[model samples]
Target: MAYSHVSKKNGVAYYLHARVTPTANGTRTMYFFAKEVKAGDDVTKALDEVPAGYIVVESDATGLPLLKKG
Candidate 1:
């Protein structure tokens, strides 16, 4: 899972921070989690199941943008 912040300037663009790990398939893999802005400005305490073999491209989920870049 990963955490990111929303752009204070744009308010729509997202800045993603993902976790990267090496895979045996000869390709690098990355992953992240999605959460809403809650408890004031903290990310949600819970996360949903992200699809396997795919990174989170974009999540206009709530306020924060959950994006995955590899």
Candidate 2:
């Protein structure tokens, strides 16, 4: 598994940095609340409380990093 602190771009969370475990396997990246998240659990919900120009990274990326989106 990996973890990143991504800010929202358009409507999705984008990774600025992450720590990949090199053995993680999943379809969706897991998001965590920086203030209330616990270990061994994954958050699959989208966040809606971000500031107009800022937000914490939602989760660890699930696959090859994306450079852009459609």
lDDT of each: 0.40, 0.34
lDDT of 2 at 12: 34
What local lDDT does model 1 show for residue 1? 32
Q: Write the per-residue lDDT of candidate 1 for residues 34-65, one digit (tens) a residue.
A: 33422322322323344444454433444444
TM-score of structure candidate 2: 0.17
Give the best candidate by TM-score.
1
Poorly placed runs, candidate 1 (over 4 Å): 1-15, 31-58, 68-70
User: Candidate 2's residue-wise lDDT over 1-70, tens digit each?
Assistant: 2233344433433323222233346444333333222343242333433324444433245432232222
Q: RMSD of model 1, in Å?
A: 10.4
lDDT for 39 (candidate 1): 30
**lDDT, candidate 2, residue 7?**
42
C-alpha lDDT of candidate 2 relative to the true structure: 0.34
Would you estimate the TM-scores of all the predictions?
0.26, 0.17
